[model samples]
Target chain A: MIGRLNHVAIAVPDLGAAAERYRSAFGATVTGPDALPEHGVTVMFIELPNTKIELLAPLGADSPIAAFLARNPAGGMHHVCYEVDDILAARDRLLATGARVLGTGEPKTGAHGRPVLFLHPKDFDGTLIELEEVA
Target chain B: MIGRLNHVAIAVPDLGAAAERYRSAFGATVTGPDALPEHGVTVMFIELPNTKIELLAPLGADSPIAAFLARNPAGGMHHVCYEVDDILAARDRLLATGARVLGTGEPKTGAHGRPVLFLHPKDFDGTLIELEEVA
Candidate 1:
């Protein structure tokens, strides 16, 4: 089951500008510009008291965010991540109830170095949901 | 500035079916089918350990969610709300930084009966940001 709201990811055309806005306007601590080739994103985290905001930019033309940006040139909310106690258990439970997990239907190492899986947007209405196992 | 994440709102085509999915699949405590005619939406809250998920559906043909659903029939994430210590102060600061606040730049009573202001999605890289003054 879903635990804490880990972080809400936003796809941005300019990661640095987005990070700067959080830094200067909101005074949030901006961390990372970590290039995650596996996820095909360059990400930055805006630290908050209770949760974090992830700013993502496409790493390549083939990146998923790239397609999102192509449609929404201004970029937008990409996904919402929820922490789980056990990734496999959560996946199984969701699958048993007919929820479709994205990707290879297995957990993969996420940006946080924890196991994560994405749920199909179609299954959850229209919002893409991500489940990350707490490390 | 933003405080805690108040909730992530998802616009669903079928409010009851969406609430049922959360209750039966994730065992989330679902509350409300509260109709806010001002916002032209009916909403439900899916309680979580650290945050809540708001499920929204169009209350009328004029509802904004109806437009979103017309484009995305499956439903999807609508907006993210963040709590602010002082709504007025937050609004001034954001405006000073060239961020355009939506709807005549005035705070309206949101679902929680708290003063809330919305920031333009274009200004924030396409993610509609809501700042709610915690009561």
Candidate 2:
């Protein structure tokens, strides 16, 4: 089952502007342009007291978020992540309900190096949901 | 300054279906169909351990989210709310950065009964942001 609301990701056209704006606008701590080449995106974390806001920018032409940026050039909320205790059990439970798990239907190592899976947006009322298993 | 991620609001066409999916998919607690008709919204809170996921449905013709739902008929992430220790001070800081605050630039009572302000989506990378004052 989903536990905590992990982090909410926003896909931006420019990571630097996004980070700087959060810094100037909110006087908040912003960290990283950490590039995850495997995922084809660079991310910066806007650290908050309770949760994090992830600013994502396309790292390559084939980046998964490139299309999202194309549609929303100014950027927008990309996905919402929730923590689950058991990845396998959670996957199975969601599968039983006929909800689709994206990718190869296997958990992949996410930005945090935690096992994570994406659920079909259509099945979840148009929201792309990422489920991360946290110990 | 921004502190906790107060809640993430998702605008859904069907409040019932959205709440049900979250409940059945995550075994999460879903509460309320609380109608804030004054705000032209009917909402349900998907309670998570760390924060909450707010499902918003248009309650009347002039519902603020009606246009959002029209654009995203299947439902989508609406806006992200962050808690501010002193909203007035926070507003001034953001304003100094030339960031445009939505509406009359005055705080309004939000869904949770906290004084809140909305920042222009264009100013925040096309992502609508709500700043709620919290103790």
TM-score of chain A of each: 0.94, 0.98
Please provide TM-scores, in order, for all candidate models, with all chains considered together. Answer: 0.95, 0.98
lDDT tens string, model 2, A2-91? 899889999998889888889988888999989999999999999988889999999977899999989999999999999999999999
The models' CA-based lDDT, in order, is 0.87, 0.92
Give the number of the best model, judged by TM-score: 2
How many clashes does the backbone of model 1 have?
Answer: 1
- Highest lDDT scorer: 2
Write candidate 1's Cα lDDT for B64-103 as tens digits: 7788888888998889998998999988998889889998
**Per-residue alpha-carbon lDDT of candidate 2 for residues B8-77, written as tens digits (9 for 90 to 100):** 9999888898888878878999999999988999999999888999999998789999898888999999
TM-score of the B chain in each candidate versus the native B chain: 0.94, 0.98
